[model samples]
Target: MKILKTIAFVGLFVAGTASFAQNADEIARKVHDLPDGKTSSFTAVITLIDKSGKTRAREIASYAMEEGTTDKSVLVFKTPKDVAGVSYLSFEYPDKADGTAVDSDSWLYLPAMKKVRRVSGSNKDDDFQGTDFTYDDLGKRSLAKDSVKVLGEESVNGVACWILEYMAKDAKAKVSKRVYWIGKDNYVTYKGEFYDRKNNLQKELVCEDISQISGYWTTKKMTMTNVQTKHKTVYEIKDVVYDKDVDPKFFTVSALERELVK
Candidate 1:
């Protein structure tokens, strides 16, 4: 009878774990599917600080729109004469029909080259325009790309959050694992940590200045720090608008080239 009882307890524990994992996945989907508007635009100031405390800043205008199961965005550099007219475009897709992970596509247009070059998958881990953020960081990652688990609860910036852990499904992924602290009230991510293939902490990101804009919760300021190098980048959004009319062609590679000539 004791052996049978032990076996029953083991079964109960396994069932409970499976239920918890399902709940975690549901929460992750909610976080991923948070509604922004159909279209949005904003200007941001990106400041980079190096380990030696040296700093550089740039201004950029960003536009994004939702198209079916995909989200697209374009970035145009506005200031700093030398870098002006440069643009970056990205398209992020939802999970494949078979529920497999797929990386987003990104391209860069340089006025000097006058050509739009595709950003390859191998370069997704590289920094974006000298900023601490990687190309992957700029795009929305599908939940299908990772296996998620709830890591309990925590408080971030005085806001209650549900801590979640994620492990990449691909062995070649830039980040092996990630942890996110998502706000319980707004479902916004408050903080995140990234680990490299070697299982060492690579970067940390913190989101602040949360506000409701056009009925959607947004993070007005974000900072990402490369823990190993002690370099950081801070981005502040301004002049944000949602559901604004945007030219359909603006998201194309041809538009990226045309905008530089303007």
Candidate 2:
């Protein structure tokens, strides 16, 4: 009886320690690690699938500067000749956990239309290019801005992962709730669910085709599906190079005026 009790105590201790591990902050840290501020260039294939299951695909070349508060970024359409010179500029910031910064300003410049639009709290949920993903979904958020809570562990695609959830404090922010699955060993997010103001499952984003670049776990493919509309967008990354020299001007408003073909 004494030996059995001792074994039971040992089991409980192991279980307790495991339960205490894997919290929200850890998961947030992994997400923050996704992009190092270092520069890089890549080609992406953006596919749009409508509720009718019609798919439209476009190839785009993009350059990004992640170093500062500017979050200078630009995307230029490469294929589908009609979109040539269709470019955009934007500065993104990491949001605080409580989402209190709903008023934080982000800018966008469109060259084909020659318009620079600003995003505000009220219209943050507006779609980008009539796609399923909203502005806030593409917006940046610093891990320091939000508090993370680990919702425990589960297996995703046979990989053990930590489930984490986050909320923004600024009651008015677009996505009120988000859940993430962080791989146990790789620390890459494999799946996530975003909930809307009504706490309904608004969208689901899945990360796939993960490969290591510069010793970093990265996903070369991602898909965002809108549950409300049954529409989906697929993003495929190519020629991805990390910490390489990128032309600073590639991220400017001029990027919108030029046909950036590689």
lDDT of each: 0.89, 0.71
Provide the global lDDT of candidate 2 against the true structure: 0.71
Our tally of clashes for model 1 stands at: 0
Query: What tens-digit string does per-residue lDDT give for candidate 1 at 193-245?
Result: 99999879999999989999989999999999999999999999999999998
Q: Which parts of model 2 have CA positions greater than 4 angstroms off? A: 1-22, 35-37, 68-71, 93-105, 254-262
Across 1-262, the per-residue lDDT of candidate 2 in tens digits comes to: 9999999999998877565544456557666656544666688888999999999888877776775554656666676766655565556665555644423455555556776566565676677766676766654564544456777789988889888888765577678788889888878889999888778999999988887888767689889999998999998889887788887766654454453424
**Model 1 TM-score, 2 decimals:** 0.91
**For model 1, what is the error of residue 197's alpha carbon versus the real structure, in angstroms, after optimal superposition?**
1.2
| Candidate maximizing lDDT | 1
Alpha-carbon shift of residue 82 in model 2 (angstroms): 4.6
* Cα lDDT, model 2, residue 143: 54
